[model samples]
Target: MQLKSSEETASKAELIWAITGILVVFFAAMLSMNIVITALPVIVSELGGTQIQYAWVLTGLLLANASSTLVWGKLADMYSKKVLFQAANIIFFTSSLAAGLAPNMEFLIGARVVQGIGMGGLISLAMAIMGSIVSPRERGKYAGYIGAVLAASTAAGPLIGGVTVDTLGWRWCFWVGIPLCLAALVVVHTKLKVPRYGTPGKIDVFGVILLVTGCSALLIWLSFAGTPEFFEWISLPSALLIGGALAVIAVFVIVERRIANPIVRLGMLRDRTTILAAISSAAIAPALFSCLLFLAQYFQIGRGFTPTEAGLMLLPVVGGNMLGALITGRLITRYGKWKIYIVTGAIVMSTAMFGLGFVLGADTPIWLIIGALIVVGLGFGAQMQNLMLVVQNTVPVTRVGQASSLIAFCRILGGAAGTAILGSVMAVAVGTSAVAPTNGTNPVYAEATGTLFLIAACITSVAVFTNIAIKEVPLRTTV
Candidate 1:
């Protein structure tokens, strides 16, 4: 009995260290991704970039993150996850250094793309690693910790950026996460000890190339369309780009089906719960990403708030996110019911988004806007991690990495698309040649934000039905 008790204690200690190591990496990665939000306008102006290029800074990262997620997921299943996680931290650290020193807009965008690749690994691998150790039934309790880290990093990013940009300059925003990343690397190396699950297999190189190519083409077209220098929405360039993207994606589907070791197993997606969860993830992602990204711009440019002030104003949303994640995570663990929270979250998110649209003018009451943001955050917090939890429940432990990453890929892809589309919409609303409204308050830009949130509301509402349709299975009690 003493021996058994000792083994249990050791196991618990190992789990604690493992989770701590990964959460550090997770926090750094998310912080790096968001730190630029408040500083983007200043960064673009200093670099002599256009409104289109401004949006590309974000979309570029999301695209790389989305595209590389599957590769990392597949690799996690085959390789030593501890080593892979460390490697991702190195990549993120290096790219962040490069981004901080970038001499031009193009260089910064390139560095961000590389940074996104590292972020892709961190995000997917963190979840994959968690799935490897914790059973689905127990994951809900731990997921609260993960969600709290996510919320903290996300909330801290804008505030950090705001402070860094105001005091040190915009470049420091990129540099701030390096220390965190290095610390995470040290912890992960010492603490994370997980067995490699899958045997070495052929990676689908062609599928990756096709997926990246197709998605990049689509995003580029979306970002540039309806701009003065680019082709109109109905023009030949649009047709060719859209058609070519579709053709490449179709080919990718075929390749995945034929490959012995596919990056994404199509068969896994056939399960009804997986499909519904994926749809819900994809649908809700845009609303979450768009709102958070654009709100920085709204506060800084629309309301004439300083970066520091704008960051402080976002606290309500962050509070909501933290509360929602913590509360739902505990409840799910206790009761083993998930669908209700996600569906209700979707409905709440949609309502908040619409409310934001209605009250988003430059002169709208601050209290009213804050209330809506809190609700939006609450809705997002409930759905984000739970979607992956449901999907992970359906798969065996060996395939958890792939299943978790697939859902992440969908969410990031949707975010990239939404950022590109909504950026274009705002650009069009502001006039094709208009630069980013960095100079001062622009009513045109402020009005366009309202339109952006309305579109986000429409897109997010789809998740309500999808989550409702998701059939929840009993959470597995064993890892």
Candidate 2:
């Protein structure tokens, strides 16, 4: 996404500072989502929450984030990216304040919902701004840095959350994020500049409602039906949820097709780059997100490691991501091509998935598990941001927000669907929604987990084939 040469080109030093400022906001947004994961137990106990209430604390954030993703993206096209970015920081900081001061579980959960609202905008708008400033040829280097931040923050979240809970108390898990958000706000205000497009006529209220409803309903169904203690997958409630989600989505499509200014640019899917990116995102994202949960489980439930120790064990995967992203970014910039890396990355990821499926297990040594994960991380770091660069490059600047956020939304939706599929298969295989590691035993659990990874591998292999269909468009040198 770029303007004509008539538009002023940003200076090299300016772009560097701009990217640096955005990275802090990006890191804060990513960290906020995961920082509460390991602190939940303490928060629940102190607040005397029920099991369902405890689950809601996390689910609230997820639902809000999913529902708000597209809306925020659309807003970016309508308003200044800098303003939206700063506003998102305010919202996140405010929610953190509320959550830290929350006297009960319900208040804390509600605050998280607000936090998610902020996060949705922060993530989407930051990328949209990045697209506006950098050309496709150079975006990979920045994207790689962004990917590294994302990977590191994700890996560090539990470790930070656990330490916060143990030393400063559960509330500080929320309070600790304030300084980071504040710094992002200051940097963005001082450094970032983005021109707004034509003022959008009357906001697309109807479309926003439809999209939020559809996404929320879909996420709700995934959260509950996928849990064995909740509604069974085939139960009446689950059927209604699935049906409602589809109906809402159908209505949303109709609205988008007819609206003057739609929240989602439905036409983008017609583009080959977008279609390929969407497919790859849908196919491969589950392997990343599901493993976050599974790896934690494998370490804690299977190996009986403490939370901090488990998080530490996952560091190699994060390290591999940083290494892979930096190398890929430099090579892409030097060669002025991305498809080669996309294809290679897909093959690498598929291989890693297959190895995790067939070669690694509970009895498998820790070194072997880490080794397989490092390969997966490398493959993921290479493909994730590079694919987005493809889609963003193809779309015009005005539609960049929609294009980038659509890819993000696709990954989220894919992860939810993949998790459901994995959970259902495991439930049917082992008669449990959750796997329990017992005395280093339970070959059935290992086999079920392996089977899930195998399914992921088969799905991801589709990307290698999909990449072949993409024609190489020359990378843009100017934004």
- Per TM-score, the best of the predicted structures is 1
* Candidate 2 lDDT tens digits, 57-169: 65566557656777788888877878888888899889988888999877887898899888778877877988877777778788888888888787777678767766787
Give the lDDT of residue 331 in candidate 2: 86
Instruction: Count the clashes in each prediction.
Output: 0, 0
lDDT of each: 0.87, 0.74
TM-score of each: 0.97, 0.88
For residues 1-479, could you state the per-residue lDDT of candidate 1 as single tens digits?
A: 11112123238788899899899889989888878888887888788887788888899999999999999999988988888888988998999999999999999999999999999999999999888878788899888888888888889988899898899999999998899898988888887777556777778899999999999999999999998777799999999999999999999999999889999899988999998888888888886666777888788877788887778887778778888898999999999998889999999999999988877887888999889989988998899998999999898778888998999999999999899988888778878554555657877767788989999899899999999888777887776
Models, CA RMSD each: 2.6, 3.5
lDDT of 2: 0.74
- Segments in model 1 whose C-alpha atoms lie over 4 Å from true places: 1-10, 432-434, 437-439
